[model samples]
Target: MTGRRVRVAVTGMGVKCPAGNDPEDVFRRVLHARPTAAVVPGLAEAGLPVRFACTVPEFDLAPYIGRREARQIDRATALLLCAADDAVAGAGGAVRGPGHRAGVHIGTGIGGLPGMEEVVYGHGERPMGMPVHTVPKSMANSPACRLAMRYGLRGSCMTYATACASGTNAIGEAARRIRDGELDVALTGGVDAAVTKVIVSGFARMRALSVRNEAPELASRPFDADRDGFVMGEGAAVLVLERWDLARRRGARIYGEVAGYATTCDGAHAVAPDPQGAMAAECMRLAIADARLTPAGIGHINAHGTSTVLNDLAEAVAVERCFGPQSPPVTAVKGVTGHLIGGSGAVEALVALLCAARGVVPPVATTASTPDVGALDVVLGAPRQVARRPVLSNSFGFGGQNACLVLRPAP
Candidate 1:
């Protein structure tokens, strides 16, 4: 098993985001370049610097979980659970096997932030009184633990907290385990519910949020010359990964193959990306190499375009460095969904897979300004049709954490 490399198949995916809940619906919304960012009901009244966000609209837990059980869990955990249920069901029920052969890997930048805020500020009559379930609900690993318990998976249950790269790292690590024969099945993705007052205000203080309060839809303009910053978003995405052979044997509907993955760090700045994007380019090259393919094989890139000035520029530079001036067309989904933080990578990965399978790339929403970063072919205005080929998805985080995954259309 040391030198062996087994393919990992993405059999099922579920998403709950600002665009929609169902994966297809969300994909369609993005394909049409419909922006979801809008002013939160009370944010302006709260006097926050940023008043707009892309939030999961009208989510009810009663349909996905028992009412009593939902009461004990945080919104983040509940979101993950709902997505997990959909993913498993989409995978033709659970992957029936020994419990130890399965695992749960979930990622989140800040877990249960709303729940923690409630505990700190008191809920209803309880003034600063901690609830018994507060600890479990607020824990970063709660999503993974709860998923494992719900599905009876006894293998490793892990959570990644690498800022925005958390989801990509979790999915990449789970694929590595399966490729190394350590696990047969894994539930891997990311979720974050950080739309609380504290989280929003914190990012606002950092000046990381877009202030296009008058027109929230146009706020997240990735790679656009007028791009200022990102808009905070909340959502969850889960994917069911299984060994390629096992998936074929079980007759699962494979969406795509997780062909390669690589992660790297810049070690340069805590919040700013390296202007040259040297390490980011290296991460992409490494992932391509891991997939046993060259840069020429990549069809397009699903950029980790956070809509921030530095991030979009750095990513543009990285693309140029990785694939040269004639790089494949690039698209950023953050313009449609805003920045989902930890969940952005997983959701964008799903979009990449969809692009590969459907033979088209969605337009980067609401970006009217010319790209300031050289001659990169940024997809805009309308979806671009292309040959079905492997797609490279990127996720870069605040602490210089960068992760890349290459997904190929199902054979």
Candidate 2:
């Protein structure tokens, strides 16, 4: 175990998503085909183009964080802290390891834009004075710093800003460190609170946001013919990754094992995916190879189906090429959660683990049929029961960032 690649165990997970607050609740919503997309409160008043968003409900932050500290941080950072706290609680109240050997890595594409907006425009009729703590709250790396300082983690810490792939890459990189014996444990995931007016308007200008202002719930229809674009969403998810041997020795409840991870850049486009999806296909191939599992061994794939036509189609092509005609059953959580930006990948990874744990593949949660070019067995209508096997979760972001993770049932 000292010299070889150490097995990494997912000892704990915490989530604050539109689907639900905890992992089991989220899974139940997915299995029962509940959708969370709806109109965002402030966007319509601001005259934004796309008003709907998958917003996290009023989760009790007081239980996990102090009131004064909460006010000083942005919503995105607060979500990260809460998720981390839940991860520890999920791991039987504490992460077992020396503080010096544990690390934290959280991903966020943009931080505190909503807070910045509030400072400039105020929450009322009058513009408010800028808060002195604005810089700390808005920094992309704030979550990572807060986690480290609060948890007394002395190991490597980082915050990835790879657009939408940030969370996937963060978890993947943390797994790498544990597998490489650089650290014994790591808390890694993604967080983003991008449901602000300015953010939505900006994406609207790029034609990247869904404009089904009339029907909020139907806006994020991934892989559907009627799908226009993704709905904005805000949420966070964090996982505690421990070296498998250490987890076993401590008798920790093992949720699953991160067996493989691989990331690649499209290098072809800034705002769009490679029309051919060659790089994405290769990214999946490499992840499977890294897991030492054949493509056929993968039981399910949690797709990065943004519901945007171009992305869903490109990802489908990549899936077909990598898994061939007999591709695994695929599902997209974005149908329910919309696009969580950096948080999308991490939260979807959690869904992947839940699939393995429950021995079922959650349905697509969208009413539309899969497009012909991207036609694969997309689980829809109802959840499909299946034997637990390695699950592959994909995250593709703007600027061509692609990440894939292979999660295996705890052996």
Model 2: which residue pairs collide?
A: none
The per-prediction tally of clashing pairs is: 0, 0
Show model 1 residue runs off by greater than 4 Å: 1-4, 123-128
List where candidate 2 sits over 4 angstroms from the true fold. 1-4, 93-96, 122-129
Clashing pairs in 1: none
lDDT of 2 at 80: 85
Q: Which stretch of 10 consecutive residues in model 2 shows the poorest summed lDDT?
A: 121-130
How accurate locally, in lDDT, is each candidate?
Answer: 0.90, 0.87
TM-score of each: 0.97, 0.96
Q: Considering every candidate listed, which one attains the maximal lDDT? A: 1
The RMSD of every model to the true structure, in order and in angstroms, is 1.8, 2.2
Backbone collision tally, model 2: 0
Put down candidate 2 lDDT per residue, 295-406, tens digits, no spaces. Answer: 9989899999898989988998999989998778888999888899989999999989989777899887765677554557888888888888989999999999999999
